[model samples]
Target: MLPLIPYALALPLLWATGPTAPDSLIIFNASRTYHYQAIFISPAGDTLSRERITMQPSGQPWVGQPKRQTACTIQYRYNPGDSLTFAARPNPQNQPGRQPQAYEWRKSTVTGVIENPQEIWMHPIRSNQYAYTEVAPFPQVRPADLHPGGSWQANRLFIMGGWGAFKGSVRPFYQVKAPATRRYGNQNLAGCWLIESVGQHSRLGNSYLDFYFHPRYGFTEMHYRFYDGTQISLVLEGLPTGNK
Candidate 1:
């Protein structure tokens, strides 16, 4: 048998030889600007309208509160060092009267994290509608490490200004279907991870989300269905374009 070594002496050797942590599940390039197309669908399966969305690194931090009565009591801050801003604008090609009233906002910006890369602000129902704000205390949208068949679940809080606050829960299941190929008009894309999340809200009932995420491109496609029969879909127009 080999001679035993002191714990302290062996610790460094063990760490050096141990497996290194895997790469992050998703990667964001602060220098690049991402573009996406948002499609609004009515409960009756009709297409309501479409909007163009652009996501980029924010130069300035974001500070605001949910439009709640307690807005004065609570404030949320998103620093530029670790967050991205998503801006939505009306599509010039859209037909007249095609845009819904809730989607009329010309400039809608939402903030998401760069580390975990999950939307921390805005309701999932409509793009930048600001109907409600979500705060996930656990914030487990995806696993920290990338792998096939990874899954996670967590609780989320929903705060609606003037409508009161409610508690909610979210369970996300992820699966790596196959190797990446030409998708969303982009010939170069990393592997695709499909995630399905089932959410239960204390007051709003149930909601469902099915989205495809790319490590290098972020979310390539997303489909959301709310309790009130509202449905929205977002698809990346193509690979992001910008310096670096």
Candidate 2:
């Protein structure tokens, strides 16, 4: 996957330079008119990647349907200040009378960073409201594993709360719990969600997501910063509602 570039950095890069196609290239199966590109540096120097991403066209509604996409990693040596373009293929989904443009078509720049970028959700509250006490499981795992939580079984009530906000309001937040027995990798003990609340009049400002981590049991730590400068948190008092 291509690294995500903020709106701030993207405009400048697009203005300066676009990717140069390399001799060695691989094209994936995609819908007609699909157009995407990427640039990276390896031992041999720099290589550019391009693909035509496909999507199932409109028309069928009764049976099951699936969209076309691709997932693969581009191997490249790491370097700071190096920039790469992660642009998507053109709009094959766009035809006469159909939407004239493809919203999914995107372009992003990936730049190496020393410290990982910071993330904070604008909205803190969840919409599916539930307050109940239930016996939570425990797991055994190592500390870092315990940090992301996976492998073991511990006892605590897994309480959760969520809601949605306006479009482009904030990013999503997610986390998993650590098990009692310190074991291996971060596992089922973790999860994530993006909440968006939409309606007229009682509009909630858009764009907010919160980050959290679990260790031990009961309540996982909440990590989100609000625009109001106020922060809020809660423990897993009980299993909150709305789960599949």
Candidate 3:
């Protein structure tokens, strides 16, 4: 017991010395139960903080049967006139394996510029369906289009394509269902775009993209549903940025 005392005393100090982000914020939110291992990150791409929160589930009214937890992170440069963007391509881990004879899926890019704390230009490169030619066929606009006047008015959610031989043949697809404007009110910018029409073969294939914006941390809630009944839901509540 005597040697254990020293180890216990050092435990608190070890956690205190853990790495943290430079100047970012993190929020942890739960829907069912508290999770001690929850982690939050910042837009500067750093771990801001971690916390545990108690949660209550809506459907099942058991003592502790269905417990759930979520985390959120924000990263942004604060230096005056500073700018940055986040980008990621679907890797083998998130996409189906390509056959030698099959046409490979090109990497899609989405760019967002930090403009104050109120607005951002989240632009994406548009392309043709069959030929893969860029939509804007001119030298100035063919490669990319930077829509600067836009703002990050809603949550951002992405669905990952799973790896399997049958995955490619299952008809990759995705959809976005907007809520009734009169009931929910049109508040989010991303939600305003209804996905009524989508190509047969799409990255969002058979996936549901859903998210809601929070005040402090921008967008927090995210839900992605796959065709085979698998779903991933995440929520970041109590973000320092207050909601509308």
RMSD after CA superposition, every candidate: 14.9, 22.4, 20.9
Candidate 3 lDDT at 185 equals 21
| Lowest lDDT block of 10, candidate 3 | 134-143
Residue 94 C-alpha lDDT in model 1: 34
lDDT to native, each model = 0.42, 0.21, 0.24
Q: Which stretches of candidate 1 lie above 4 Å from their native place?
A: 1-26, 59-104, 116-141, 163-182, 186-190, 242-244
**Residue range 1-244, candidate 1, lDDT tens digits:** 2222221000011111222112321233345565667665656787655666666543222233111101001112222321122123332223344442222343544443323333211123222332321311221234353455555544333333322232333332333343445477645565766666666665556666667766566566777776667576767778876443
Clashes of 2: 44
In terms of lDDT, which candidate is stronger, 1 or 2? Answer: 1
Error of 2 at 101 (Å): 35
Error of 1 at 43 (Å): 0.3
Predicted candidate 3 versus true structure: per-residue lDDT over 1-244, tens digit per residue: 2122210110111111222221322221112221212233332445433333222212221121112111222222122211111113112232344542222333232111121222211111111111111110101110021222221212122112322221222221223334221112223323222222111223324433344432233333433333333333334433232111
Which candidate tops TM-score? 1
* CA lDDT, candidate 1, residue 8: 9
Please, what is the TM-score per model?
A: 0.57, 0.18, 0.26
State the TM-score for model 2.
0.18
1-244 in candidate 2: lDDT tens per residue?
Answer: 2233222111111112222122111121111111111122222333333222111111112121111112222122223222223123222123335434423322221112000011111111121110000100111122333233233212211121111111122222223342232211233343332121111112222212232333222123332223322222232322222111
Model 1, position 190: C-alpha lDDT score: 58
Better of 1 and 3 by TM-score: 1
- Angstrom error of the Cα, residue 161, model 2: value is 21
State in Å the error of residue 241, model 1: 3.0
